[model samples]
Structure formats: structure tokens, C-alpha cells
Target: MSRVPAALTALTMALLLCSGSALAKKDAETGAEPNTQVPAGSRHYAATGFPDRLVASPAQDAARGFSVAWRTDTSVKAPVLEWVLAGDSPDVGTPTRITATTQALTTELGASHHHRADITGLQPDTLYLWRVQGQNTWSAWNQLRTAGRADQPLTLLYFGDTQNKNLSHVSRVMRAGIKAAPDARLSLFAGDLVSGGDGQDDSEWGEWFAAAGWLPQETAVAPAIGNHEYFEEFEDTPQERRVLGRHWPVTFALPRNGVDAADTSTYWFDYQGVRIAVLDGTSALDLGTAKAQAAWLDTVLADNPHPWSIVLLHQPFYSPREGRENTELRDVLLPVVRRHQVDLVLQGHDHTYGRRGEGQGATPQFVVTVAGPKQYRLSDEARATMAPVGEDTQLFQVLKIDPSHLRYEARTVTGRLYDGFELTRGTDGRKQKTELTQGRIAPRDCTRAQTLKGRADRCWE
Candidate 1:
């Protein structure tokens, strides 16, 4: 093997050694030389605080409860939140205040922290304004709606991979998705939350969170473990890589409805009338820990008692990308999902957008999409298997569900509705499907799309 540059190795080592406090000190004393800790007052606003990664869950039960999550710097004095009902006019009244804070740690990049809190005692289907703060810094207050009730209709946004060009390019797509459904109950990520691999370095995770910003704090997120969350085997000793999963538990406070053995990230939640089940596909597929998760998945599905059931994960079982298919996931997980009458299966890993069809009754619709700038080509056979497919850059789907029917639309980054459909279940126990006539705009060339076999990028084109 070639000799590694000493400077690169030193830089990496120094970054790895710095704790959150040390990183804060480094940021504080940057004007001076190294090896000194600056006073806490010297740090900038962003250095001490920033609101981000907001996601909202649908109003549950009587539409009185919703949740949000975000991240901050370790130096944050105390995390606090204030919220109130939304108004058409700007003169918003004061809201009940809640005080919360997060713990921080250091990685190869620098110091970081995560915060998650559920805002309860809300009015049904009503919009409200909210914001977060740390120390002297305060966040701009945003608005969100709580779930109305069990019989009320609701909309949600679903995405695949936003791992590449996360904060820079992908942010626009995320923002567009937010605007597209300003009242969406929540947004879902089908894994690949970041482009991290092997080394959970700063760039990988920072870009991902930056892409979402305070959206996580504003909404409730159900994140699955994607392949990118894992590192390549070479970076770690064999044993270390085997036990690796994620820091999701520390990031978002999801409902603990999954297998007791699995962590919080791989769990389910009943938001309003929908029972959302999220699985750790990367762990099952790559970590040789499928049995435990599989058994847990079966139990969760068997126990679900909601009007609609949806599953989210990183890998796509009905993949159009070459070598990217998850046969084990399909055989093991799909049957369970089908048996439980799962309404939809959302995923990302192919880096393209597509949806698969089921011939009839309560058949699950499989969708894969990409919100990041990095794009991938789809396989020719994918066109036949999917209702619609898009290459290059694009957002994915916005789904509206009610007791009588389900509607979804797949839009591009430019706000063009590319594909759409509706699934309606009638009183007679028959299911009907209808496809909307949406023309394709900028579908790209995919002659050399990469073939995804494992976690690595296999092709440039």
C-alpha cells in the first residue's frame, strides 16, 4: 500500500482528538494561535446556537399532540422553546414556553449536539407558531398544525436520498417540498440521511443535518438506517465495524414501538390514523443482524391497529438500479408488510425516483426518490416495473390519505408534477386505481448508471 501523508494523518488525528469543549475553544480562539481555549463569550451566534432539522408528526388522538427535533452546538447554555397558534396576520400572541437542552460530543469534524421535544396539549387540526433558542441566541418562530382527529384527512411528504450536495443543492429541494405541502403533518426520510461511510467524519453528517435545518425541530421524523450510515470495512477493525449502527438515538426522539432489542431509530409510531413502521435496512442487509430485526418487524406489523400502515427504509427491494436490489429484504420483509396490509413502502438508495405497482387489494406501493444534487440513472427494466421514473435531480412524493382513499403526486425539483395516482378502497371491499396524466419534463440520459451492490459507489457515469 502507498504511504499515507503525515500531514493528512495528523490533521485527522487532531480532529478526532478534539472534544466538543475543545472544538468550542478552537472556534472561540481562532483569531489567535492554537493550543489555547477562548472564553465562552467570544463565540459567534452560530458557534453557540442554530435551529435545525425540524419535522412534525401528525396530530394524534384528539389532534392535541405533535413532535419536533433539532440540533445545536455543545456550548448552548440552555435550549428553550416558545409556541402559539398561527394567525394570518403577523401580530402573534405569546405561547406557552418549554425549556429543553441537548448533549454534545466531538467527531472528526467538530463539536455537535441534538435536541428533540414533543409539544403536547395542542388544539385539533389547528396551526401554531413555534421557535427554539440557546443561551443568548433565538430562532425564528415557525408555524405547524396538529393532527385533527382519527377521521380527519392528512397529507405527508416522503423522500429517498438527500445524501449528496446536502446543504447546498439538496436544501432547495427540501425547502420546495416544505412549501409544496406547507400543512403536511410530517416528512419522512427513507434513509441515506447523510452520505457518511466508514468514517463518520464531519462533512458527512454536517451536510445532512444542514440540509434539514430546523425542519427536524418542527416535525416528527421516522428515519431508517441507510447504507451510507455504515463505514467501509477497511477503515475499522473487523469487530468495530460489526457493532456500528448510528447516532440517531441521540439525534431524534422517536416513539419506542419497534422490537425491544432494536434501538429507538428502528421503531414505529401511530400518528393520527396511520401506523408508520420504520426498519433498519442497512443493519439487516449488511451487519448480519437481520434475524433480530426481522422478528421484531413481524411482531410490530402483527400488532399494528391503525387505518393505514407504511414502512420506510434505506434499501429498495424493487430497485431499478443495477445490482441494487435487496432480495433478502424483499423475501423476508415484504411478506410481513403484505400480510399486515401495509399501504406503502418508501425508500432511497437508487438515487432516482420510481414507484412500483401491486395488482390489487391493499397492495403496497413502493417508492424511491432523491432530493440531493447527486443523481443516478435508472435501469431499463425499471421503467416497466415502476409507474414513473426520473433521473438526475428531483424531489419525490406528497401523499394525502383519508379513510376512503389515498392520493400521491411525484414532483420534480422545479415543482413540476411528474407522476400521480390514487388508491381508493370502497365499502364493497374492492380497491380501484387511477393514474393521472402528468408529462415528464427533464428526464436525463442514463446509459451508464451505476450499479449498486453494497455501500460503495461502483460507477461514475
Candidate 2:
């Protein structure tokens, strides 16, 4: 063999390395290896093993317990959480550690892991710092405050569907809600958290989590599963055949004391002096869980240990739109609510703002609101029944509960009070409601000439 030039040998080796790299890139893009993990650069938001989508939910007991759920890449087989008392100064000491129960799931993006840990033995009304550990990394410290004992005044923030334009439009509304009620212990989501196909769209979920920011980690969330949570095979398919999204159960570590142990989405929890029951309206109407949920609701209400009771569902009994009537759910669940004299019914799915209830007696007040950019025109029925039907507007609500009274306020995205009311219960058990909005603002009508995206009459067809 003749002696080759040193530069020529180096050039030949570099070309070979480049060719190999190109082949590897092509194989990754084409998924030539089924078991190979997807490249992080190709993933939506490039999710990693470090915790993301952190959400806290009230545990079996809110006063001394709570749970946190987060997602990580598949590489993290066992995730752990560490916590210590939150203080002004950094005190180096051993902290309580808890290992999370994890589930491996393959999403549309790729394989991922969901981890949940229930932390108990916490002190009431105390703040704590916590962080989650992945295989080789740890998340930044997050703060959590336990709920005060019963009879203590509590505040909660309520939001409607954040399914459309979540990151761009809905994020502002949620941030505004948190800023308005800084002391709120929990945030209630009225469902339809995402509006992607089959509810497994990784980008949509990423946007949803990004819009939520640090709020979910700080304040606990109680969410209901809306009709959008269920994916239909075809538009012509029957409602009874709809199926829940694959991410519904794994993403949320809700209370499992519901009627069907398999479905923890429908459950109840008591905080302060109020009892909140989360019902699966989609399951009730489509999955043949109505009767069972009704029975469960009756039993839960009958055995209630709290004076104030509220029901959270995705669909409204009194539909805000013309063709969105959920007659089956109303027929089966309304009777139970009436019998129990439920204090309030918070719902979503209409995409418009509505409020209707009988102020005379024990009828549960109903509210339908939307928090995202998607808006729909209110039907004639909504206009006739709802006191202040709002369209083409995003809103959030704050509810303050005390021993004898409850004050509720609805505000627009910019923090303007749109509607408000107060409920007072007397010693003799007589209840009265006083409307707080006295011609403060007119109902938003999209039919009027309004410019949106450089188009006139954007709210109507």
C-alpha cells in the first residue's frame, strides 16, 4: 500500500462519520426501530423527565392531605417527591420524602410516564415547599398550602371551558383569576380542558399545561369531564357509544370514591364546611352511568356531613343553547339535586355565559360560563331564561364561602365584574339570594356589528 496523505485520511474519516450521522437521523425520523424512544427535539414542547403538568388535587381530607400529579418522560421509572416547611430563610435539613405511583402510557407523541403522590399528615393552613425527583434531575421547589379546618372562611376560583386557543387567549383569563383571588385555596375547572382530536393531541395538552403555568402546582384543582373529553368515532354515531379520552384517567389523580371505582373522575370531596360532588355528565348520558351516579349522589347527599353542598358537572341541566339540551342527565340528576337542596351547580360546555335559578327556595343555582376564545351565540331559550346571557366574552368566577353566607362574583378577562350575587342562610334555615349587579353592564351580544380579526359581525352567522 502506498503512503496516503494525513489530510486525505482525516477527510475520508469525517465523511464516513457524517454519512453515519445522516443515516441515524433518517432512521429516527422514520422510526425504523419500534422500541427506540422518540427524539426530544421531535416531541411536542420537547417534554423531558423533569416534572411538567404539575396539578394538585385535594386528597381524601383537605385539612391535612393533598395529592400532586405530574408527567415525565419514559426514562424515569420511579419518581419521588421531597417536601419541607416553607419559610423565609433557607434551612438545610432532611425533608419528608414520598415515592410516586407511576403509570407508563404511550401517547400520540410517544411513550411517557404519569406520576402521582399523596402527601398527608400536613398541618392545616400551613405552607410547604415540595419538589419532584426524576431519574437524574429534580424539579424546582413548588409551594402548597393545606386547607383550613371546617368553619373557616374559604375562597375558590371557578373557570369554564379552556378548550380553544388555550395558550394565547385562555392563559390571560386564568392568570387574572388567580391574581384576583390570591388567597383562593382551590381552582375548579368546569371541564373541556382541551379541544384537540380525541383529546390525545400532545401539542394541545402541552399548550393547556403551559397556559396553567404555576397555578396548578400552587392551588388544587377539581375538574369535571365535559362532552369534549369523549371522542366520537363519527358524527353520525350515537351518543351512547362515545368513549373517554385515553389521557383522562392517567393525567388526573382525582378521588376514587366515586360510584364506579374504575372512574375516579366522578367523585366528591369536602373542604372547609362545603361538600363538592363532581359528576360525569358525559358518562351519565353516554356511558350508562346516569342511574348509578344519581344513586350515588343521593347517598352522598343523604349522608352529607357539611351544611353547604355543590355539584360540578360539564353539561348543564337547563341547557344554555337550543340544541344542547341534556335531558337524560337532567331527568336523572336534577331530582337528586332538588331533594338535597344543593347550594350551587357549576357547569360548562355551552361556550356562553348564563345564570338561571329559583331564588325563592332551595333550587340550586346554575351557571354556565366559558374561559377561552371560542364563543357561540346564545339561543332564544338562553336569552329568555338566563338573566344576563353573555356571548363573545371570556369570564372567570370567584366564590367566597363563610359560615352563614356565600358571595359569588363573575369577572371578565380584564377583571371587570360582569355579574355577582350573594346567598344568605338564616338561622331558621330560610335561604335568600340578592342579585348584586344593578344595571352595571349590558349583556354582550355578538349579533351587533363588532370587529374581530378584521371582520364584522364576528359573533353571529
Candidate 3:
């Protein structure tokens, strides 16, 4: 039997804590934060009595309906969302107003108001100008296009985890993706958009909003729940529990069509010809909601009406990181995914890029990517798999889907193509694939990134 001194144990624990904190330094290091929470930035806009953090989200049918949510100082008693169709005439049409549902959230930064407005009854595939009322000012008139008809071609931007240093390192990647496709319809985030979601602080949300500037207001976003979206039960308790972040529903007025057992964060919506099915992996993995989510996923996929279907969540069905596997999640969702033959499954959390399965009818493409600066080790499976896995690089994806074909390109923040594929779907939904490797950049062995100035602290950790 061995016994350690109390003072020695205390010193050891302190060193461990300090070492962990170093990984989350504000500077742009590489590697995954490993469930670290990025601290809040400022309260300047929060106390200004003006609306900020404006985000437009997809409705069950974005063609005719959508939602927008914003934050403001609590002093702003009344906040309203107004919209009008874009016209050739300088004078916009008489704007229709929707009073907002404002809720107050008191975080470490103090009290702020969150306003959400779900609007419907608009014409499909139409361009609209919208803004939210602030104290006496209004946010810039944001232009957004509603989902077009089913036969129309569609473009979308997909990013993995932007969970750490959002404003610094992750912002440019977003800018690059948007620059590549200025008219992208929906921005699909695989989860962990922010590093922290414990509800005690709202600053990470601030950074996220500041990072994207006005992008969120233009392209609608569909977010899934990552583990970081869960809050620590208590500081003193050694055991960790999953509590959904208070800012989630307040940040985005997501569709309410998910399973009744889960909250609004886990829902599916159709945009143009695509059916985006999002699940709450954090809740399923930690809160004993696997069966609930699995059942909902089955029903949602079974009745999908769109030609192209994709699933978004935080955890991947087949993780490419070595020594890490989400068998539980795969078990719960894979059967449903395979049964319905989902076209693609997008995930984050692993903070790396890897893909498994062919992008076809029965074999859906399973992809994991990281847009934030954090890097992770690549798994042997990833190296073996040709979905072209890599490390030490931040990436974003642009996907264009039409009636019978889908073209996808994954590029680094510097605008270099890393991996690409084109799929041609037959009448039966089965797709023939073509690889786009010409001019593709070489892959970096980021799995050992810590050695190279330590990518956010090597993902091999």
C-alpha cells in the first residue's frame, strides 16, 4: 500500500489544472481544446441597448417560413422584426412587422434580452430584406433568399467545430467559405460552434456573433447539439453532468418539429431539395436520450420528401481519430441511417477531417471536419480510408446539389482544395461518384501537430 502526502497531492492537482488551462490560451495554437470552454469576450454590445448576435435559422419549410433571433440590452423594452420583399423600386414594400418574444438571460456579463421572431407566409424563392428594431436604431437591412422550388439548384456551406478562438482563427475560414459561395442558402454547423455553453457566461456567443459579422443574418443556419453545449452540473462536484446551454434556443429560433422528448435544438428541416436532419448527440450520449433520438431519426428519415438528405450532429458514426470510437452513437443512429439510406452524415466534435462510406444511395458519405484552429490526430482508419483524412489544417466545405447531381469541395482556409467528389444520382437515388483530385493540395501529418509549435496543442492528446 502507498500513501501520498496531502500537500503533494494538492500541488499535483494544481499543476494538472494549470496545464489544462494553458491549452485554452487566447492565442492561436493548434489542436483540440478537449472539451475546454472558450471564455466570453466583452459586454460592450450587450450593454448598448442595441440588437446583436442576429442569426437567421431554417423553419420546417424555409421556402415559406423562417426565424430570426437577436440579443440586446434589457433596457430595450420592445423589439420587433420587420421584413419586405426586395424590389426594383428604391422604396421597399410596406414592411410586415412581427413582435418579438423577448427573454432575459443573466450571465456572468450581466443581464441581456434575447428576442426571437418566427415569420411565415412569405413567397417561396423570393429575396427579402429584414431588420430588427433596437433602442432607437435598426440593424442593417439583411438580405436573405427563401428556399427555392424543389427543382432549383442549391448551394450550402458546411463547417465542422468552430468551438475555440472563434473570432480569431475560425472567422477567416467562414469568410473563405462564404466568399466561395456568396449565395449559399443554409450554413450547416456540425455542432460545438462555441467552446463553452455552460450558461454561466454569454461571451462566447458574443465572439461567435462578432466573428461572423453579418454572415449569420444572411445565410440561415441549422445547428446540432455538441457535448460542449452541455454545462457542468456544478463547479465543486467532481462528476460531470450534461445540461443544455441556456443560450441555445435563445440564440437561434430553430424549428420545433423534432421529437417531443427532446428540445427544439434537435430538429429537421427541408431547404430547397435537401432534407437536413439534425440530432442531439450530446443528449443521446450523456443524458440517456439515445433511444428517443434514434426513434425520432427513424421517423424523420422515413418520411423525408427531398431528393438529397443529410444528417448533422456533433459525434461521428465512424470517427477518424485513432483510439477513439463512438460505437454507442453509431449503434443508435447507423441502423436508422442505413435503413433510410441517408445521403450524408456530417459531424464535428472529433476536431479532424475524415470520411467513410461512399456518397451514394445505400452507402451514405460520413464526414468529420474541423473549421476552428484546433487540430486532432488522424486515425489509422482515416489514413487507410480514401475519404482523404488530414490534420493541422482548418477546413470548410461547399456543396452544390441539383435534381440529379451533387458536387462537393473541401478547401482549407487559405483557399486550397484538399478533397473533392462529385456524385450523379440515378432515378432510384443511387449515385455514381467521381473524384476531383487535380490540383488538390498535399495532406499534412497533423496528428502529431504538437511538435509543430503545438497546433492548439496537438490533437493526438
Largest TM-score belongs to which candidate?
3
Residues 1-461 of candidate 1 have per-residue lDDT tens digits of 55575556657645544443464455345442221122222222123356654444433332676655566777764577778888887788867787665666555444666666667787777878887775576777777666666667888888777765566577777788888887776788877676543233354455566666656655555577677666554455655553343455555656655665456547776666777778888777766656777788778778666567788888887887866768888777777877776778888888877888666554688888877655666787887777567776567578898877788888877788877778787886455777767564545444544533222342221
lDDT of each: 0.66, 0.80, 0.79
Global local distance difference test of model 2: 0.80
lDDT of 3 by residue, 1-461 (tens): 44565555556445544544554442236543433334433244344666788899988999998899988888886689999988778688799999999888765566788899998998899999999988988898888999999899999999999887777788899999999998898898888888663322366677777778777899998888777776776546777666777778788899998887676668989888888889988777777788888999888888888788888899888878777778778777788988887877888888778877754443588888999977777777778874588887899999999989888889999889998888788997767777789989887665343543444446533
Instruction: Please give the TM-score that candidate 3 achieves against the real structure.
Output: 0.88
The local lDDT score (0 to 100) that residue 372 gets in candidate 3 is 91
Better of 1 and 2 by lDDT: 2
User: Predictions ranked by lDDT, top down?
Assistant: 2, 3, 1
What would the per-residue lDDT of candidate 2 be over residues 332-351, giving only the tens digit for each residue?
98999998899899999888
Error of 1 at 161 (Å): 0.2
The TM-score, computed over Cα atoms with residue i paired to residue i, of candidate 1 is 0.78
RMSD of each: 7.9, 10.3, 6.6
List clashing residue pairs in candidate 3. 29-456, 30-455, 30-456, 30-457, 31-375, 31-455, 31-456
The whole-model C-alpha lDDT of candidate 3 against the native structure comes to 0.79
